[model samples]
Target chain A: MTPQSPYALALRQTGDVRDRADFLDQWRELLAEAVDRLLQSGVTGGTPCASPHGPKTDVDAQKTAVLILAALHGGSTLSQLAQDPRPLNAALDLALVSFVAAEDNTAARTGTSSSISKLDL
Target chain B: MTTVDSRSGRRLTARGEKTRAKIVAAAADLIYVQGVGATTLDDVLMASGVSKSQLYHHFAGKDELVRAVIDHVGERIIERERDALGHVSTIPGLRRWRDALVQNNALRHGAYGCALGSLASEVSDQDDAARRAVSQLFIEWQGLLAGVLRRLQDGGALPPEASIDQLATGLMGAVQGGYMLAQTARDVTPMATSIDMALAHIESLSTD
Candidate 1:
């Protein structure tokens, strides 16, 4: 919420360059780690490494996370334009519902929708 | 005596109004190309070819000029989107609107990106006035999308459990994020992919 929030400042750029770069790098790392953690836990389905010959579960998860993040920031764009958070809230639902629905499908294959309620998300 | 506008009580003349519009459009373009922090009044004057006196007559200061630009850009963006937003109640219509946005971005070749969003992320953090304006523009944008979704729901194209507001927000977010990624990477693929995912969610909601 600071005046220097990355994307808001990325284009306008009233802040230090090194600071902005550092913040962005940190953000990427955080998102990557978060996705990896989720995949490793199987909460998002599939192992973090999955298999050497199989789809790179971590990479796939990170991609999805980034897409979800983009939708979110886009939602914020809409929210800012509208001056209301309702659309942003709707976007959160949009990403999560689709996500949870997919996860439920995977979990259903494993005979356990039980973990769906476990995640605070 | 200073003249007063009947609507907003601002002193202005017909020529002054035209001059102001010209200046605002020039300023918006310049600001879009160069960030507001970097685009000066002199640059605006040079780009717009409007005399310094006229600029001063219409706007008290740089901040005033920037505010005017914000309003001008807001109006212009909404105007451009009006067609797709209105009278849309079918699933195909939603796809058309989404595709049109993607096509518009593609036409730009992923350069400069969204007119409003380009300014939004930059100014949203810069000043209180700019922040408020950006926020209001997004709200307006979301309302337009939500209105169409609501119509679809009423027509039973969307399930009764569907929330128009959320779908609209999610759909808008996808575009916003897509623009950001596409602009930063100088690629249109992300924008297209993001729109697809967003639309896919909407498609999933459709009874048809």
Candidate 2:
């Protein structure tokens, strides 16, 4: 981690920029701030991702980390209140277990790739 | 919602708790990897090493089992955060937390979105119980983050006018969105970029 991780620093510095049309929306700005805060906060628990069936995978922790960050940074159809990143932590527990169970060493690198295929906007 | 029979003092039997835990652990694994819609009671049974009759006894049905898994996930996740955040109250502490996240995500190259979001997208519409369980988890998590934000505020780490509730909500959304974008894009850039931007904006508030 850099002395001042760029994202965390960004989250700490807040402003309502009125001039820029690209980054002026409240929701967008809020998301940026939250991401920054999350980056600074780091992941709370060292809780490893569970992959019930598969051998222990290094991706387990990474999976949990990304999922939680995604929840905090991503948008949802639910109410804004429901959109809080905190849910990411809860979701990470579930994901960790699943990852442990389904550890596919061969396709580990591709997991992210697969997600990208499905997630493209 | 089923009423808890408080008057009757109905509680999970020791056998029931063991059975319930197995089922939840199995379900948590299967649903997250296979997608909730793709997973089945049979899968849960096979993974959990529980018999059909035992599964039914522990849970009224599959929906109930999913709810149980959600609860289990919520408990585990909440415990993890409480432990991590409890370690420190300084800016450096917060940085450690963020470092953990980035390091973890970078490990897998940013694959897989959140389990809760996965369920929310796949099963929320089909299962009322699942929706409620997932929703409850979100509420609890938000409360936890808000508490942390409150601490930051009290320390004057955050601006006096900062809204903890809003900040918590925003943080949650960005994480979710970043995952979605990352999954779709097949790249970690979206996740990394989103977080960086979010952090920059958050720090802006501290300047005041």
Candidate 3:
């Protein structure tokens, strides 16, 4: 027998179908918002505000940017990880570490930390 | 005293420090809302009102900005947890700490998960510093909770064998798991159940 998802069980217990649908929609919105934020932060190339922007500078910095963006983008995958029984968690741990190190080093050299003031958002 | 830029080899000015603070604040807010990957130097520049040259003058590029953001995130988490859980080191503090954490999450309706955990979930596969920072934060947080448990043990309210580290790690996992579950279900059961389960586990361990 296939195992039911914790989310599926949750949906079943809801007496109000409309409420359930609304809840699911809201959750999706939240997840999307999260994903958008991470992508904007620059997990991949082609997006504006990427660390090195276009190519030709440093290959490592560009790769670092990609990993950082990818890590943030991974938020959507939590459900998959939650269900998986393998060493997925360890892999995630390693990936996140690499992203942070890369991002931090690039930022440290860039002096991005030294400019601008407060963000209203 | 002068601080040399690791990349540019230029001396950092006091004004430069101020500008960096501004950039960090702006980047942090952008990352907080947009999740780091989605935020851009353009966003930071706009939010910070810093010109392009000014941005470049400060950060060599966007990667530098992200590093500052992570550092800021770390400092903020440490301070917040310190303030929030400061009272947990006493014999009568266990229940209070538990309630504070539960109520705080409930008040947010689970919309705001732990920022570090959020980042970890987002980038654990790619950022070593961030991964380490998140792990450090968890370890620090767990230590605080464990300290409280140790106090209880000292007061004879808990068993001497009570492993605070294990319990604290368990609590952290539950909270992260709970938030994810709650987000998926768009309901509070995951949050509520996780808290209830953790609380039940703690109580069962109590010798009182």
- Candidate 3 lDDT for residue B180: 49
For model 1 the local lDDT of residue B70 reads: 81
Off by over 4 Å in 1: A1-42, A45-66, A76-89, A102-121, B1-11
Model 1 complex DockQ against the native: 0.31
Q: Per-model C-alpha lDDT, please?
A: 0.66, 0.52, 0.51
TM-score of chain B of 1: 0.90
Candidates by lDDT, descending order: 1, 2, 3
lDDT of 1 by residue, B1-208 (tens): 3445323567777776778778888999998776677899999999999999888877788887888878888888887778777878877887888788888888776766787787776665457777787778877887888898788878987777665655676677778877866665556777877777667667766666
lDDT at position B108, candidate 3 = 59
- The best candidate in terms of DockQ: 1
Chain B TM-score of candidate 3 stands at: 0.82
CAPRI docking class of candidate 3: incorrect
Q: Estimated TM-score per prediction?
A: 0.74, 0.59, 0.58
Which window of 10 residues has the lowest lDDT sum in candidate 3 chain A? A112-121
Which run of 10 residues does model 2 chain B get worst, by summed lDDT? B1-10
lDDT of model 1 at residue B66? 81
lDDT of 2 by residue, A25-108 (tens): 333456445434433343312123332433233332333344333433243323322433233332322222223222332122
What is candidate 3's lDDT per residue for B110-184, written digit by digit as tens? 554556656656555556665565556656765676676666667766666655554554455555555544544
Candidate order (DockQ): 1, 2, 3
